[model samples]
Target: MPPPPNYPASARRNGEEGVVLLSFLINQAGQVELSKVLQSSGSSALDEAALSALSQCRFTPATENGKAIAIRVTIPYVWRLNQ
Candidate 1:
């Protein structure tokens, strides 16, 4: 599994919680590129943190005809504070 984002202290204190939907490219090199937030988590801190963390992930590049290719994908990062 990819590493999880660090919860921002201010956001945590404010009890902010939501899902950040992100669109990004997984390049042929299995590296993340050209990421954008497609949906906000209602908190900039959470959104930014999700972006920063997910950007560090390395994905298995999509393959076609036994060759790697870049692909654009959308995924959600969920944030919630424990009760």
Candidate 2:
């Protein structure tokens, strides 16, 4: 699974924190494809950062009947400002 995305600086200064749910397809070649936000964190910057980070992720593709297959997945990203 992809690690949590970095908190955006703009968001940090404004104290933005929440979970963003992303939906994407994992291709047979173990690549993240067509990523989009299924839910929002109430901040456009946070949402954009989450999508940007999600785009950089690579995954072990899902398998079916011993063969690699594309699968849709949802990932939740939590962004909290450090005190």
Top-lDDT structure, candidate number = 1
lDDT per residue, candidate 2, 25-48, as tens digits?
999998889999999999999999
Candidate 2 at 34: error in angstroms? Answer: 1.3
lDDT values of the candidates?
0.91, 0.87
What are the models' TM-scores? 0.94, 0.91
Q: Candidate 2 lDDT (Cα, whole model)? A: 0.87
User: Mind sharing the TM-score for model 1?
Assistant: 0.94
| Best-matching candidate per TM-score | 1
Worst-scoring 10-residue span by lDDT in model 1: 1-10
How does model 2 score by TM-score? 0.91
Residue pairs with backbone overlap in model 2: none
Candidate 1: tens digits of C-alpha lDDT, residues 19-55: 9999999999999999999999999999999899878
